[model samples]
Target: MAKVDILNTKGQNVETLELNDNIFSLEPHKDLMYRYLDMQLTNSRAGTASTKTRSEVRGGGRKPWAQKHTGRARAGSIRSPLFRKGGVIFGPKPRDFNKKLNKKMKRLALKSALSLRLSEGNMIILDDISFDTPKTKSMKEVLSALDLTSKKVLMLLPYKEEKYENVKLSAKNISKIKVIIADNPNQGKTNVDGLNLFDLINNEKIILTKDMVKKIEEVLV
Candidate 1:
């Protein structure tokens, strides 16, 4: 198990938390991380690059000249691929780039990413964070209090609800700060699969609220 200091919004340490070995102390797998990242990036591609084919191009209905005569070996549509301003041949078209990884592999990859972040000492735990109103200044104050003003921070929040609006709106305009909802009691069962590997690996630090700690453990453990 890995023990870490739990801090308050003021950046003061209030308690200690012992993390589950299965979730935070597991060995990091570089290859699995690479595969997961590659899959995620590849799957996000739009693949909407398209081109007009010979049959689809305009001015192709009428033949340029006679089929066989008039000093011409053969004649076809002006939009033929061999002619100038001709339609493309075998060009790219719209498609879906999504790729799938099995359940077990995805779980292992997430664990590997989490373990790597924890080992790098980039993970933090907060007792709780809230705001009465949706104010960006309040959120900035909280980040400043935690000495994360300029750091890329990923705050794992509780599940979606009206109450979280304050914090969500507060952090919206702040650069280098992203808020993601974690599994919560409202959601009876764990939703570990919803965790995004790209966000986890992209951020420089991970900050989990007290509620999120148990929720993640429930799912990941």
Candidate 2:
């Protein structure tokens, strides 16, 4: 187990939290993390790039000129790849770029990423954070108090319900902060499936409530 300080919104340490060794203290798997990142980036691609081939181009029904008769080189369809404004050769076409990693591998990768952050001392366990209404100023004050106003922060809430809507809305306008849920209560079990590896690794800091930590440990352990 690893002990970490749980800080309040005012940047004061309210308590210490014991982290699960399985999730936060293990040695990071660099290769697995890389693979997960690659898979994520690959799956996110639109893959909608397309180009017209010679056969698909318009106005290419007949030969442009007789072959070998005129002073110009042998002529073919106007849409020939060699001609100006002609179709492309071996051009790109729409296709899937999705990459899949097994559930076990994904879970391991997430653990690795989390462990990496913890080892880097960039993970912050918040005692609690919320808002009565959606207000960016309130969120900014909290971040300032934590001395993370300019840092790229990833905040994980335990659930994404009406109760947390204000918190989510408050953090949305912050350009460097990203908010995500750690678990979905409707799933009826401990499911930390909402954790995103990209956000975890890309952000410079992480902030999560104690409940969110429990939810992550319940599933990851």
Candidate 3:
């Protein structure tokens, strides 16, 4: 069994939450993690970059010169690539750069990412992160206590409820803080068959729950 030091609202240790060895203690597949990270980065790329080709450029429909030129090379049109106003040569076109991974591979990648957090002591277990009202200042205090003022912080709760209203409202406005409703981000096995788990990589802090920990553990292969 593995254990993660549990913390309270004050950023004080409550206790070590016992973790299933299957989830938090296993070795991460370096290759899989790397591959998933690479794919995620590629998929995130807009890949909308494009340029018009010479002929694709507007105007220049009329021929600039006839077959017989005045001691100069014959020109087909001014927009020809051969000329300054010509369309681009092999210009880029919009494309999908997304890389797909098998459901199993994606799960493995997410597991690897989680495992990394555990090993690095970046994973935190909390009894529960609740709020009485939507107070940005209170949430800001939580961030400060965790020393996550300006870092990319991901706060996970066990489930979704009205209690999170304040936390959500408080953190949502801040670009650096992201509060994930457990019910949403906890899509444990929705697409377990066809996954892109690479999205779980590089997060600064991970909240640990027995249920989520178990799910992440079950997919490790």
Q: Which number leads on lDDT?
A: 2
How accurate locally is residue 197 in candidate 3, as Cα lDDT from 0 to 100? Answer: 40
Q: Show where candidate 3 strays beyond 4 Å.
A: 182-201, 209-221
The lDDT per prediction is: 0.83, 0.88, 0.67
In model 2, pairs of residues that clash are: none
What's the CA error at residue 182 for candidate 3, in Å? 4.7
User: Model 2 over residues 140-220: C-alpha lDDT tens digits?
Assistant: 999999999889999999976655668888988889998886656655655344788999988999998998999899888
CA lDDT, candidate 3, residue 99: 95
Model 1, position 207, has a per-residue lDDT of: 88
- Candidate of highest TM-score: 2
Output the lDDT of residue 67, model 3.
75
| Ranking according to lDDT, highest score first | 2, 1, 3
Candidate 1, 147-210: lDDT as tens digits: 8999999988866655565787789899899888754454455533257789998999898887
Give the residue spans of candidate 2 off by over 4 A. Answer: 185-193
Measured by TM-score, how close is model 3 to the native structure? 0.79
The TM-scores, one per candidate, come to: 0.89, 0.93, 0.79
